[model samples]
Target chain A: MADKVLIYSRFPKTMMARFAERFELLDTGGKPAQDVFSGNELAGIRALLTAGGSPLGAEAMDRLPKLGAIVCYGTGYDGVDLKAAAARKIAVGHSPGANAASVADIAMTLMLAATRRILIADQYVRSGDWASSRQSPMMRPQAGMPGRRIGVYGMGEIGRKIAARCAAFEAEVGYFSRTKHDLPYQYFPSLEALSDWCSVLMIAVRAGAETQHVVNADILKRLGEDGYVVNISRGSVIDEKALVAALSDKTIAGAGLDVYQEEPHAPDALTVLPNVVLSPHIGGHTLDSHVAMQNCVLANLTAFFAGRPLPHAVKTA
Target chain B: MADKVLIYSRFPKTMMARFAERFELLDTGGKPAQDVFSGNELAGIRALLTAGGSPLGAEAMDRLPKLGAIVCYGTGYDGVDLKAAAARKIAVGHSPGANAASVADIAMTLMLAATRRILIADQYVRSGDWASSRQSPMMRPQAGMPGRRIGVYGMGEIGRKIAARCAAFEAEVGYFSRTKHDLPYQYFPSLEALSDWCSVLMIAVRAGAETQHVVNADILKRLGEDGYVVNISRGSVIDEKALVAALSDKTIAGAGLDVYQEEPHAPDALTVLPNVVLSPHIGGHTLDSHVAMQNCVLANLTAFFAGRPLPHAVKTA
Candidate 1:
């Protein structure tokens, strides 16, 4: 019999179809009516196709006794309890850096939207307001991207790509990573220092207990009246309430946010603000990104089924 | 006595104040009231502080017999009859290459907005539709900028800056210019060929009788179903009616436009289209641009009064 695989989350239809060809595909196919199967169904599951922030903690891991590998669809795998999976000798694999360019590109998109007031400008023309006045409602002049100081909070793949794009726009790119690197970007040791130094602060860190609410009221306030914030990472990385207050109160000039504290439900506070550019967390959903991610998951799955080391294996330590 | 200067359009109050320090000031000051003076008043007008497409053509030039220079605020003097100005020995001045960075930044902004469906994304969140569905209304996956071919219709300073910015994003930049330069970008001599070769076509050429409506239905249709168009140049460069038909019929993918065929009056056809990102003609209206344009006009005026070659004199021939 083909080895049974638990599809813990939805994969691209093509990927799911391809997986079914090689293994017995089971579990919920993105149906909210049923997410996890009974203990008996998962008991003999040898592998699982999943995504970052999945519900694959100790409880789910305890049920899947035959599972040898958990292949995550996208980069962040914080939901998988690596320590527990390691104790059970189950390797975890994820598509790392697969969507960095897409996410970074979105970050820049948000930056331009907010800074240039494109949202308001579009509305102004659409609403027939421009007919009455040639000048757009007295917006602060956008000095363009060049020569502006851009500070990235997490200098990972996404952050690095953002920095690279910023440099191309002739911006002064800097980062506050955990450890200093020899890269040309100016390094700041702490978030506060980076916030203080740059005109724009980008949040691109992973979401976890340690990083929860890393950007709070104080950071937003420190970013100051002229500063701009753009977050393309996990929504939880920023304190939504604080962000709302900052934008509302003009503590910061504006924001471009793809993710929010709640999925699907954008905060009421941010929804009403004119200075912020809000999206429904579409950082890595590009056509190219989805294809890359699927290829990564398939690589890990194929490597594992053949009794080889999984590509992109996440270290348990 | 200060040389009389007709303020044909509104400049920033600060620029006006500074100009007052140097010369006699005049205008309706952005009011909708009468701008042109009586024929008796026009006879003494020595210079005019105006912008592109102002009513300072041969008729107005004929009226202002004493006018030696028509100082345009920003580039693009197509509205002025250069041959007539040459016949009359009336010099023209415009701030060249002043707002290229800002306009290119906006072009990229509209490209991202149209491809990523950012305008709809923003509306989805604001309309509370996202709360009902986590997935944004099914959109064709936007391929990120990198490796995508960006074609330019004009290879002027603005086009060069745009290509440089695109290269930074890892896009393959090419252009269709009348004269080929030995630059890194691939050069196509014909608009149709460039449209066929590129995923994104940028309209950045100047507007004139010869160049008006250059991007007609044939050019847009050549761009095909997968192509995107971004225009930061004169709206007359595009055939507004043909573009509307193409967009309505899905002959082309999408468009990001800052200029329209008529100022302040957005085309009713484009207003309802979902695949377009529209902005009123505000591409070069930034604060920095205003300052630079004022400086150019001032430089020309100062040089003209001082009897030096007008610093940015437009060649009549």
Candidate 2:
């Protein structure tokens, strides 16, 4: 007799095989085709493996009467109903520090891309107007990494990692957090102070109610001319309207963004700005990081079935 | 009495006045109306303040018989005849480290820009076809810094600086130099070995007889499917045709280039490739670097007139 596993999301086949070898894996593989409560779909399920982006509604939770635990295969558990899980005495676990390296890499990449205008130059050369456009003497020379200041807002794991990478470019690094960590960096008491101190301001905080619109119009004003902003955390951290105004007025230099408030639909104003850089919210979604997240899911499942403490729990809502 | 100072290139108005107050400055300040020597420009010139890019031919050297020293404003002294300077007992001094930091910064900038596709993403958003493009998933996640391998060729000052910065990203840093340096990071004995090891390769060496076509077809093949190449050094260091072949064949992932074999003229094949990132040669030509170069010119001039040792000298051709 083996413990039964319920997978709520489609995962890599490698991980699925590994899970099957360990338990009598009842792979539900994808979103419930009809309703989640279809005949015996959730019966004998001891644990559930889930992910973000897909809605795991209360109705789905109600079907899993035997579900003892739920594991999120990502840092965020936005799709999971934590309140509902607590009501059912389901131990919910989320993967932590699994995607830090990937997210940090993207942040640094965004900063570099936004600052250097890589895509712009490439397009110029490719479009066959290289001779007329580039030969002009008045064109400003490409500025490099050294002597630039980079400010990291929210000095948590991702922010610290980004700060280290920026420092490698010989850029002076500063950061702001709620509590001062005894690190060897110049800590700003506030985000505005950090923005004022840097040419590139990178956001690497969590995306939730607490950090929404932290980088508003006032902060953009302080970032000033010849400054760039990069956001890889969450779109909610910045006021999109403020960012557009600043870029339009040339109050700040530029921006590199990977996340947005509405998501998949960035502001038309931001999209049109010559100085701004944008990417889809694909940070921390690398193949390597995905594997890590899945592994964390497996570990949480194994531990919970053995009556062990959940690896990563959401203490609060 | 002040010694006669020949101002070889245009200078800022304030800088010229400062020089005039310091010495008996000659005003060959604007673009020359005719040949520099034919117009009696060098009749009594004892010291020369030189410009970069334009060549100082044999004719100019012949007329400036009494010229005791040539103070080069930038790094490259290809314009000046070093042998002639040595024969005439005219010491030649140049600014070396002044642009090292700037060049290093540009190299890292190119690397980041190229690898992350910042400009491409920006253009995608701006072109009003963001929805169409979002259907295809991106290659790498955003802001993931750690566990990347970065290889540096020609491990000089700029290369070393780039290595330090890449390390800050928590990348596994490696290098291939003429001789193995006692560096903290791993040193690949050959270019092939380094290419095999690194996902990203940065070229930061001098461009001359010694390092021509160092990154050719063979090395590109070794870099393979997952690898990226960034050239901040001279374009002559890479074989443009071979690079285009690799890129077109999809043998390697992509490239970020700031230099080309032909100025203002890049290969059509490279420009057309979606993976390749291109830029006009402005890596070391930033405002900050230009100001530094001017200051170096001042320093070299001051030193030569005062009979002090030159800080940076071109020892070889």
Candidate 3:
């Protein structure tokens, strides 16, 4: 008999196809556990698969009496109640850097798009503005990447990759992280200093309570009128309201965002802004990234069922 | 009295303000020299300024009999009749490599936008599809930059910068140029071989009679179905009809174009395609690049008027 793994989050059927072949999945279809499965079925579940940004608390864990591991599908595990899991002696595992490259690639995409005003240019061409020789203030010349300052907020896998890419464009790179690493980029002690020095600020910090709303009005103000911000990390890292106000008043020139305060829904105010470029939160949603993450998920579940420690387990405080 | 310099192309007043301060400019407002100036004025003209892409054939050069110098405002001087200038002992100068970095940056912007389908994603969000949890075929996972092959067709200043930027993104860089140089990227003997080996073909070759329509139907077929082409050099490098057909029939994945065969007008058939991303040939239209190119133009004109060889003169065949 195959081990039973409860699916605690909503995922595409195709994404769960591989897992279904290996385990007898008790999928809740993103609903409450008791509503989807009987007490006996829930009680027998030994492991659960979840999106790292979906909330999974102690109450949900208590329902699965035999639960031994909580496996997160992506790099971030912010939505998982780590402290609650720790107290229950439940091991937490995640695909640590599996999607880092893809996420970093999106960061670069957003950075280049915002800095170059590509969306506006695309519209200008499509609307026959170019053919008519109509002048648009938005089509004015912009600053290129060379000699521009790019400040990264975190220096983890994604941040490091972003820094390396920016440096290749001849942009001077700097970063602020909790712990400094021996990298080629200049290190800043605080986010404020980094924002003040750089014209483009890239947010790649991990999502946690300590980092929530760290990039607020003051930080946006520090970026000044000719600055830009690119966020590929969690939406919680920035105060969305403040960002809108900053862009509206020209406090900061523009922004390119792949994440939002609310998933599957960005504010109408943000959507209508001419200076901003918005996309659904898809930083790590690449074909290669999904395969790598699935590999990690399989490895973690296999080890847990085999009565062994997870090779990619996350260390909890 | 200041030296007479005929403005051979239309320029914004602001861009010409600096030149006006030092020269006696006879602005033609992009009109024919005969229509805008008297015979005396045209005959006395010893120097002229022109946009690099504007045509200046022998007839036009003959109109200004005393023309000693033809100063091009940008790196490319393809439209100038080099043979005609050389026969007349008229020196030709251009802002060579002055806008290379800016042009390279646009190449990257177009590459990332097309490869990642940024325009589609932006529409998905703004159209409320993302907010409503709607599925889009275009939103499917894409291949990231890391480990992707990028083939540059030229090794000029712009091509070298594009290769370096792509390399920083962790892409495997390759190229094919007229003469091989000592560079870090793998060099191919021909564009056909380079296109076959790489997934993304970056067109950065100099525009000239010898290189017209080199990337034809056969070359597009070599790229196959999962390939992309980004052209920042000139539209004449690729056959527009072949490119439109390839993109429409899915012979190649997509394209990002900054230039078109016809100035200020792209064909409706090409514009209607969803896979391609278009820009209005603003590759070197950055503030810093304009300033740099203007400085080079000033230097060339200053030297020519002083009865010396033009400082930035282009060696003709």
| Candidate 3 steric clashes | 0
All models: lDDT?
Answer: 0.81, 0.73, 0.91
Model 3's TM-score against the true structure: 0.97
Candidate 3's residue-wise lDDT over B47-99, tens digit each? 99998778899999999999999999988888899999999999999999999
Cα misplacement distance, residue B173 of candidate 2 (Å) = 1.9
* Most accurate candidate by lDDT: 3
Q: Show where candidate 1 strays beyond 4 Å.
A: A1-3, A9-24, A27-36, A134-140, B10-21, B28-36, B134-138
DockQ agreement of candidate 1 with the native complex: 0.69
lDDT-sorted candidate list, best first = 3, 1, 2
lDDT (tens digit, per residue) of candidate 2 on B1-317: 88777777654454456567677877665345245444465667778776543356566666787787887766766557677778777888777767777777677777766566555565556665564433333434332336788899978788888888888776789999888888888999988899999888899876665677889999998887877899987777899999998888878878888888775678777777777667776566666777677677677777777888666666763
DockQ of each model against the real complex?
A: 0.69, 0.45, 0.82
Residues A170-214 of candidate 1 have per-residue lDDT tens digits of: 789889978887788999999999998998998888777788898
